[model samples]
Target: MIAALIALCVFALSGFGLSFWLRQKQDSSQPGEAATRGAEQLSQLRWRDFAKLVLQAMQGRGYRPVIEDGMPADGIPTDGSDILLERGGERALLSCKYGTGSIVSAQSLLGLSKSASLRGAENVIVVTPGKFDDEAERIAVPQHIELIDGSELWPEVRPYVARPQEPTPVPPTAASNIPLMAWGGAAVAGILVWFIVQGLQPDSEATSPALAPPAITAAPPASVPPAAATPATTKPVAPPAATFPSDPAVIEQHRRETANAISTLFGVDRALWSTQSTLMVYLSSEQSDPVNELCPLLERYPELASSRVQLQPPQGSTKAVRFKQCRTY
Candidate 1:
């Protein structure tokens, strides 16, 4: 009983702590807002700070620091430049490009590639907290180099950015009572657990089977022969159900009609039929929730009720894919 009560208390306390932590986190900025704010702050950072940020982001991606003479004790260049990273016995030189609306050029990427080859590095990664030019994309695609743009980089450094601090609205007296309430809740849970544990235990006052006397019974006469055994009955098995065949041409028509209708909605840029059963809708901003907005609009088309819907938010938005068909069932 005592051990169970202790365990219950621990569990209750842990739950309370988790609830409080989650509430605080929810009170902070949303993912979309944080991504926008953090990107702006990242662009304004000094070269040294930007390099450190890239190092931290790379470390989270399973890359470890490769100590060298030019590198400082912080695992980054002393001049606030690039850093060397290694993973699985392979070395990669990482460079950071920071600036608002900055675009990395093909010439810059070509130079970085040559520099990596001279350093005996097997891979190269250029992290620009902005966009990359078309030419740069072509150059990196055919080489042993990887590029991390703003949309991909924001999620990595979001945790490192400090959340905007706000003053507590609760009065001092009310804030002081929170811990007492938590303890009271824990104590109540522990008592309930103890009572349940006690109830499950066997009672000593109940009659024991070994101590009770056996009942006497008389056997039937052997002259009356045993009756004939009855035959066993068997149940019939049911046949398997058939699947419905989906038409590719009809689904394509539904996609086109649905796309035209959804394009008329506010804030929607355009829609495309990526596949026969899949529809991709592009949004003008991250504030749009297609599941709530577009799902209802899509329900008007009965043919598309079974098709999948994918929402593509604007660049740099961390919002995940939203499916329209998920709401049908």
Candidate 2:
């Protein structure tokens, strides 16, 4: 009885704590106005710093960000996107500017704003430290240049901010038709395969019985009972035995090799191996050694990108092998 009371109290306390914590987070969260002001301040950074800030905003909105600056024009080849964002087929271009004066002339915001429209920007937003003047505000509606000032910036950003959605509840059931159908198909295939492989798998159980030590009976005293008049000569006979690989490890290794060969032939193998089968593969994990190394080399020599890896068996019965025709993916 006491234990039940303690359990009820614990449940009640947990509910209360969860509700209180949720409400507290709601209360302490920054207001939209404050966020806009912070964004306005964020506009004043240089290109490198601007890239970081844009990435920060993009991450908040669940957009994947890529830093592309300080490279040759051909190297990066950006479409003049000051800040680029990609998310679920939505691409955004942000023109960030930090100036204290009112934005009166559209001509004033150059380098990014003008280049923005010409570059086919789907969405254009201009962030500034101060509010837009009447002329700037008047031009915004027509030009589709979203203005972000100290007052309205945060509210706009807040709406765009990404939040984790609650997961839908799922029931634990194993009787569903789809899974059952899949399992049924699998079972049928397994049975068929077992029938096929049984013949290929030697009858080791029978083999084991046959390989047991052979019986030996004392040879009847070498005597010729009735016809002892003449001496006879006979050749010795040897026991009949067949050599089979009964070692478990050797059987397993052979099985693995056969499976690997089958997978490679079907192009379903994921293991890193050269075609020769003699070359042991070594891979670089931290940084994709083989692929990453090729990209830069391709930049230097474009022809290398078109090459291919030649697949061939080893020349001799040698265990050591070599690979040729290394190229980009």
Candidate 3:
């Protein structure tokens, strides 16, 4: 029994440790993904701002803004949208396309290269949060035009984008470890029972009923006289009344608190709120396991445990939202 209990404890501790470790690792990587998630926000910027971002990225590569006659000092054109960058006395024309929906075509690159050559630029650079076509890539090679697609553009502007700050994940509480611990304890108990049964078998086989010693008996002493009986009166007790909040304001507050608590628990940075008793949480499409970790923790707030949870997919995603609720009846 002792050995089994010890083994069960070890198993439970190991499982709990592994769960906490994994959560911490996931928390650590969230900061890196912060910029990627910020991509949605980045795509929403105005064209002018996007052009300025491209300018900054080019400047980081040792390019300086070449202010021309009747052009903005930032090298951004007031009449047109193209930017001009100069490095080592060589000029490059830059075009910034922000949306990720469309692809850059070969015809567009041909025109851009011709415009750059007319403007006395040595090279042309097209930066977009979208991909370029095969023909565009082929033309770009001969024209000395640099194509910066979504894959390359994100890294270039990641430093300039605003990333959400996620809170540090705290160690998993004992309550979170209950389910796994219960399973571990059950396994240990079963093994201990089997051991106990096996040990009893040998003892039972060696002992015989015929060789057992006779039982002994003892006489009772004289009884003393009973004291005078006393009577006492008691009043009936009533059970405590159950209190459930019915006010709209109070319920809404509880709902918000519950959502915030859950978000903090998982280190999610997005706003979490409840609608019609269903808590909504937003997460990246790649993250689905956190939903599993969420359901069990709902028990921490008994008043709000009845509310169902819905996970909203990341912005501009087509994936369906996931809904879950933990019930204790």
Candidate 4:
């Protein structure tokens, strides 16, 4: 019984040691697991914040980085490239994916490569917190696209990350010259005002009369002798009569003028005049019949008022319209 109890204690100790050793080995193998988890957490940040971090990281690498403006909430942008980085004449196009679970696919890499070419970038980079698919890596390799995983995005690792340099202050002498510049500007303005006043002043030479006003002379009024009133001769005056033109040219001219007036006033599309003084107006389908508007105009011309006026639609197949006779004064 004593030997069996001692053997059981030894077995328990060996089992505990074996478990601890296995745990340590597993932890050692996954050294990057913590960093991967940290990067994944950052993927939950807002898109703007993520982009800002990216900008800072690129700037820290001695690259002049510009975060391209994103689309407004209401806008949909066509370009997928997000950031531009330049250094020593070398240009790089960067596209970022902040999704935690979204995997970068082969098609996305190819699209980024195409965008880089269009933008004249020598290098293309795809930054993502999420892992890429095997096909994505394969395609990116041939296209020379560099993939930046979340593990590589720690901003603290970049030595050059800093704010942009502030502008230099102006010298005291240069600042003092501001008042002198103001005074000089005032003097120039005063000179301009003086010139304007001089120009506006009336010229006495131009206003001067070429000759003196003619002297008024008065002559004695001539006396007239009174004449006896004689009986007025009576002459009969005939009333003026309205005369129609006998010439066909004059009649045609009148017809054209009447047609033009109807077209302009009533928005008629076309007007035709017959030799019998009849007027046919083609009404645009878009406009209502303008007979009420035409009545007042027709009253002014006795001859036109007496002549037959027909309103027809654009298509002759439609019915025609005739207005009642307008009262002539």
User: Which candidate has the top score in lDDT?
Assistant: 1
Q: Please, what are the lDDT tens digits per residue for candidate 1 over residues 147-243? A: 8886677788776766632333546675566667666666776677677777777766555887656877888856743453445568888886433
Ranking by lDDT: 1, 3, 4, 2
TM-score per candidate: 0.40, 0.29, 0.40, 0.36
In Å, residue 251's CA in model 2 sits off its true spot by 96
> What are the Cα lDDT values of the candidates?
0.68, 0.45, 0.65, 0.59
Clashes of 3: 0
Candidate 3 clashing pairs, residues 3+ apart or interchain: none
lDDT of 4 by residue, 171-214 (tens): 67855555555455545555555565567777677667875466
Candidate 2 Cα errors over 4 Å, as ranges? 1-51, 66-81, 99-104, 109-114, 117-120, 154-329
Candidate 1 residue spans exceeding 4 A from truth: 1-33, 99-101, 164-329
lDDT per residue (tens digit) for residues 1-329 in model 3: 55566656666666566567655765667655654444455567777777777778888899998787888667777654677778999998887765435587755654565467667788888987667887567546644678887657766776766663333444578446655655565566656665765565545534678766676777796675455244455888899744657887986775664454345333233436556657777774445445544554455456666667777777887788777777643
RMSD of each: 16.9, 27.1, 22.5, 38.4
Tens digit per residue, CA lDDT, model 2, 1-329: 44344444554555455556544554445454355545545455454444444445556767654345664332222343466555776655666554445453544442343344344445566765456775456435433467766455544344443441222322345223334444455455555555555556666675686676677988777666776756687888888643435676764453343223222221122223343222222321222123332223222323333333332323342333234344333
Model 3 TM-score on a 0 to 1 scale: 0.40
Which residue runs of candidate 3 sit more than 4 Å off their true CA positions?
A: 1-35, 99-101, 162-329
Residue 110, candidate 2: how far off, in angstroms?
6.5
Whole-model lDDT, candidate 4? 0.59
Model 4 residue 91 lDDT score: 88
